[model samples]
Target: MTSVRQGGTGPRLIVHLPCAWDTSATYGPGDTVFGLREGEKCILEVAGVNNGRVFIDDVEVSQGEHGRYEWTAAFFAGRVQIVVTSSDASEAEYFASVGPSSEKVADEQFNAMVGEIQKFRASLLLGSSSAALAFDDSPGRNKLDSLVGLARLRLYAPGFLREVWEICRAPHRSLLQAERRVSLARVKRLHPLALREPLIAAAVAGQTSESPSLELLHVATSTAVQTFDTPSNRALKALVTRLAAQVSTLLDTVVQGGLGGELQEEESRRPRREHFLRHLLKETKVLLTREPFCSVSRLETSAASLTQISAQPAYSRAYRHGTRALLRGVEGARTLDHLHVSPTWGVYETWCFVHILSKLAERLDHFGWKAIRHGVVSAAESYELELSSGIRIEAHFQANFTAGAPPAKRVGWSLSRFRIPDIVIVVQSAARLDFLVLDAKYRSKRDNVLEAMESAHIYHDSLRVRQQKPNFSVLLLPAEADVPHLDADSFLFEHEVGTISQFSPGEPGVERCVDLIADWAMRDAP
Candidate 1:
């Protein structure tokens, strides 16, 4: 309790104000008050004020152990008044303001930051919960800039809730370990934004990391909650949910100026703001880099920002639209050379785009003719089908040989597998040939049918399952090769991959490859 003496000779007035959420009750480890999901998001505001000039006054409060919110002002005189209210009206107020004169109040500067934080928080609840959604009205990079502002000021706010700053960061190994010995609920009280920052930053520091930090906010009638679930060996789950219930219009009026913009945004790019970013960077920030299955990829990067817009719906729709648009635009690229390539890069936009496409094909609940299985497809074939259109079959496949050390081990698997012939094509019903296995060779010349047949026979007889041998085994080669067919139909001169001698072994000609596979499918059935 912080109170200022209405009448007194004390150098400082002792004014005791109430902490937020006094009635709704403080949070417990399992309490559902915050409703925070593992990946759920909401922009948050955890603001504090010090009017009493209380440097020694350690105002301590918390939602759990070690997660304490403590901030000290200039110094606690014999008396003072200090208070912390949310940007919203009437949720939960955390405060104790002390001052020599009861008239002394919260600084308008502080109030303005709270106001901006509130506006952003309010906006999160408006549309939907998914941040990656690409809606027309979705909040963009601007939300990150605004969130940065709150991140900056909140770090130094006069209450003793300082570790909220660190906890918000990626989390220091030593400090967190030390915190466990303290108590519980001491950690959840800090703003989720404050807690989320460091985690996002680590991704930026990694060998490869760069992405936008988006806001995910959920709003309810009296309160809106932003939360994350942390796994613990001893604890079932740790859910950190921050709520703002006891907000006043007057206070919201005070702290609304702290929200911000993106690194390159017109406002954020200004030279004057360089110091602000520098300060944020210097403050030991961290942000959550891992955002799988969620949008608003709030990963930390080279820059620090405080923007907040609940753009879940906006981002998703935008990404879907944008990718589809990008794909439609790809027809101009006639060859593989046109695809962007950078050396040593572990990931790329192309990869992300392809993955997202798979996500789309899956999500719309639409299954195409692809449901029909075709003969085996090569690795290149699988890659092509996903990217290319028109003539196609199914079983998007890949052919790969696991390598081994010694030469003995090397020729090992490759020879045995290759023994059966690389492919089998089918057209079905028309041919009663039973089954046809097509062996593709780089050699422009034909193989010695008797010798090759003997090797293949050995491989076939080894098949664990016994019934009947393949009705026909094919050997496709260049038109210039010698012909030897144990069974007259067993061997044929067919141009597919390339001339036998000069053929590039791995590159399967797309059309030729498909025809060969379809041939096998038709033959193998009977």
Candidate 2:
């Protein structure tokens, strides 16, 4: 749907996308074709030049005659760029905005996925016992790795800023006792200790026997005044200041992480991300200049102040939630620092792992289960959720399982060279250890689903745990519509291998999958 016209004598590039609808016109640095569903084939035809090469997402594509390049890629969501370069170095760029086929609102779905990831990262920060939970050790290190954390900040920062601004506009004030010198006639409540000196001076001046002159009797009086220098206000200011500093740090990180270099020319031609970060920074700066935040002294954030804010009916929601989210955002930025600009499939895969773990935790709670160790699993770069009910769920994200790998790294022996699954769940109980291999495929197409199921088959047949095969090897797809009923019945449920369609955060389908897995784990519980 996107049409590009070269300004001068250069190779003309036209991209034909398989979009379900045309909602808007072309905009931004590159021409964008909207409503392009995920897993659809797109064609790029370049004319008026020979020996020209086409690149989709910076990878050169094999082209046929007439410079026609067809791309039938995997489950790719978000903006994808197509660059066509001629032998003379003339280049034309076009972008394709791909969305989920199941959901109409692509941004909402993507934001929801990011929110889930943030929640997961937050849980790790609180539940992790190992030192490997450090930010530098995060998986998927890339220059744009901070984008995910930034996206989370962008999603919640506006509301947080608004709340802080509102609080500053009418900040909490309390009556504070103060001492000031006042004339005898004006002093309503004079302090006895402070009046002694004035009385002694009056006696020395021969005024003690008679009514002391109002002008001569200057005594200190204790009075109360309503001021904004309360503990809650100071805490509010501290949190806002911390928020501003963190946001500024994030902006600097983005700029230093090559936002305007290769990302500018290749991946992100539009300055939307940079612009968003700057806008957030501006908002935080403006909020800091408001009433209480400007005048109130900084107070170290403590549990008592936070609890006070939460206990107050007026400031509870805004201050309490704002402070918690600010802290969580900081932790998320650190923990998920390396997860920026991850592929859509990677995002979905991580979401599945977190979503399943959360649901399993809830399920285990019914059986009086408590978390014993929740954090990174040593140097393997995996997350582990261990419960007191003799159940430990360790998630291996894109881990290599080869014969030569260490025991901690290898889930089970694979007959092949190396089997790297998207997510591998190892449920260790008192009686037995069960392995559940889940392959997250963002693609919903029938062919892509069948191809993705091959991984489930491979894990089921090849992976051996103590000479026993895996109990369950499932393919986690995006939505229910992605899998056909016939295929689900004939190929998935009939065998030990299954398909958990609609396996996304906050989706109802997730409960069924969680129950299935939790039941399997609880069966081996002693």
Candidate 3:
């Protein structure tokens, strides 16, 4: 619970929010969340159009998402004068108000609606296809559609925390303001794992018969290393190690669509390089009109409104972690070459789109779309360059070699044009480099590394390019995940070059896979 004191001609309005549901929780005091309430009268500022004061009916008003001024003030008694200023500072006025609570819902109703929505969405997710989510007209066909707290932008606590921290430290002349932002950001971003992890593990282990525990999804999600700072570096690294497989989806998206597809279109109406997304959007919109089914949803559907609502939040709008990935998969429509596409693989889908968006957003050079507000990026401003470039030299072979044949090899794909691995790594480095090669194996579902190591013979044989040496290779292994237990050695795969190196990427529980790979690239540099 939080409390704030506000000034008025009448008794001070001391607002107490137990659940912290108000936007004031985000912006701090002096925001409208507390200012507008029953029996309140105050002048409301309307400035953009012109400096004008509107006498508001406070009791009848309600607050909007991100819009605080959309409220009324009720003054049964003599009005108290308070200066209301437009966000632009163009308008200011004096007035009075009773107080504001018109926007706050009954706590019980608010929670029930959230529960209902989660339950219903959880049910829909289990279905194999959109057809599986048809309108049954049953009692449970749909859940409560409460407009308040509808779970859109259900912020990750970390996001809120970080935002609060920044707001406090904003460009105010006073350092105190900045300190306040830092405090808020910390609150939101603080690790909730101690409270959340055990439940998440139980959900993962139990496999409940009812709705799939979103807790597992939350675990996978909250488990990500999305932020970076010297202080949080340890936790970030851990998340990266655990979430490495998840991050791969992002790179796979780039391999699919040229991340700059819009930049290469016919040059007549081409905007700036930054406006590439604008072009993509124009193109996608055109496609939506001409080939709607082919472009986004694969199936032809009669749920036009539902489709429109679903597609309104473009693939680019979500957080950097997965927004690009989801968009890329939707636009490119394929997996990372090796994985098969499945309905439940929305993780893979969203993953690809977010990654692509990250790349495209970083490289865009113009600001036209930023002003127009298509609602894709966080702002019109460009994103920082991607810290990690997801690329590698991949050589895959579809055909196995004949026993007596002098080995002829095929390179499925080699990213030599831009990226080349400084060191060729073999899985466990056991296979003779000339005979087989394994990059990195990341399937906890598999019992032992031996299966991956044994399979290397086939991959190694395919790579039989008789180099000067025995073509020995190296396997990159996570030192923390049981490098010792795997009994890996340079000779594990029957080659001198085979080896294992152990180094945990981050703290025990917080790092991601990409962070670990990045660590390897840093440490592995010769």
lDDT of every model, 2 decimals: 0.25, 0.60, 0.27
**Sort by lDDT, best first: what order?**
2, 3, 1
lDDT of residue 220 for candidate 2: 69
Task: Residues 1-526, candidate 1: write the lDDT tens digits.
Answer: 2222222122221221123322222321111122221112222123232222211111222322322233322211111112232334222222222211111112342223223322322222111011111112222332232332222233232121132333333321111211112111233334434434464334335532554333322111123333232111001001110001111211232233222322233232233233333333333222222221121223331211111111233322322322221121112212211111111000111122222223323432323423222233222122222212223222221222222221321211232333323432222233231223434332232344434455345433421111223334443332223443332322323311121211111222323433434444433333
Per-model TM-score versus the true fold: 0.21, 0.47, 0.20
Which candidate would rank higher by lDDT, 1 or 3?
Answer: 3
What is the per-residue lDDT of model 3 for residues 357-433, given as tens digits with 9 covering 90 to 100?
22233333212212121111111111222123322211221222223323233212221121111123211122322
* Best prediction by lDDT: 2
Give the Cα error of residue 244 in candidate 1, in Å: 41
- Model 2, position 495, has a per-residue lDDT of 86
Worst 10 residues of 1 by lDDT: 233-242
Better of 1 and 2 by TM-score: 2
Q: Could you give candidate 2's per-residue lDDT for residues 186-253 as a string of tens digits?
A: 75554557536957456546766786566766776678988777777777777667767767777776
